[model samples]
Target: MSEQSNPIRSAIAEAIADNPTILFMKGTPEQPACGFSARTVAALQALGAPFAAVDILPDPRIRQELSEISNWPTIPQLFVKGELVGGCDIITEMYESGELAEVLGVEEATKASDPNVAPEGQPVQAAPLGIENRLR
Candidate 1:
């Protein structure tokens, strides 16, 4: 981003950079404040893919800044490798068709989404619950 951007924009950029797969939604992944957010979380969780979520409820400014950063006027936005992918609808479709796993580079897309899959995917490999909750 250019230096002309605001400080908050810079912070959002930094946050997204720190996380590999990011979801800028209306609430936390575990306890989503909105139906869309909850569904979005479920989609990713079902894929058993590692990802980081960001709740846009704390500061309305964050929501505004995110929109400006991505030029997307939606709350439940998805990003892969710092690139804006799509929103909840897209994720849900991907989850159903097993596209998310491919995008995340998981070997067994169906098995990964299956809860029966051993060694369930975690937020962080070396850090336990380090990036667990999105609300925090």
Candidate 2:
């Protein structure tokens, strides 16, 4: 079917295009329904990054459509500035290295929400590398 006829695809497109940071996850960040999602949420929360999250579990088509669009067959798919930034493990590593904060343009904290702020730094310019997290 054409994307015009598929509301799910259209919605996914609009959401990705509209939001600077969005996560197509299995559940809300506040209550992630899966372990990977929970970890992903925690990483974003640690960075204090505000993101729009879409729960793909509510509709099977949402996951399918998102996968088709992103060409990444996984939930908890993170998009930063309209670009895919990989899934749980990548996010965790980036969070640890403070790359996520740079990507989100937030002040990189030595620790999450620590009072002692570090000097302003530039974001690491890196291409999105896909790390498949097919484990359920």
Candidate 3:
């Protein structure tokens, strides 16, 4: 079977269909293809749990298809159990705070930079408004 037609494709789709948290990235967790991808991967690693990673580089179709599925035009889009979480910028912001781990049901990563506060002398964290509570 072709890579696009492989059962693993559907299996990966189904696996992420209801996952609580997943990141569709350009490379594996161990090796990321871009800086944004790297940041997100590092954040996931900090969560210290097994999460799904889909390399969009292998197939051209998946990029289009995933965009259709999530309506997200970016690679590295995060899905919290089949639900669209956000893009890299949003995920990074959430990671700097303690929210991403809470939503993903994983322990927060140890950070040299505190999510409770910003490094550049920012005051109290602004409440994250658009972050939806998990559906599954």
Candidate 3 per-residue lDDT, tens place, 80-125, comes to 8778888788888887777887877866644444332223322211
What are the Cα lDDT values of the candidates? Answer: 0.68, 0.70, 0.63
Window of ten residues with lowest summed lDDT in model 2: 127-136
Tens-place lDDT per residue, model 2, 1-136, is 7866776677777778877888878766656788888778777766666677777886687788888898998778999878999898888788878888898898885345431221133132221121111211
lDDT head-to-head 1 vs 2, winner: 2
List, residue by residue over 15-100, the lDDT tens digit for candidate 1.
67777788888766656787767777766666666777777777777798889989989869988888887887787777667777
User: lDDT, candidate 1, residue 64?
Assistant: 87
Error of 1 at 55 (Å): 1.0
| Per-model TM-score versus the true fold | 0.76, 0.79, 0.69
Best by TM-score: 2
- Who is ahead in TM-score, 2 or 3? 2
Model 3: residues >4 Å from true position, as ranges?
Answer: 1-12, 109-136
Task: List pairs with backbone clashes in candidate 1.
Answer: none
Residue 14's lDDT in candidate 3: 61
lDDT of 3: 0.63
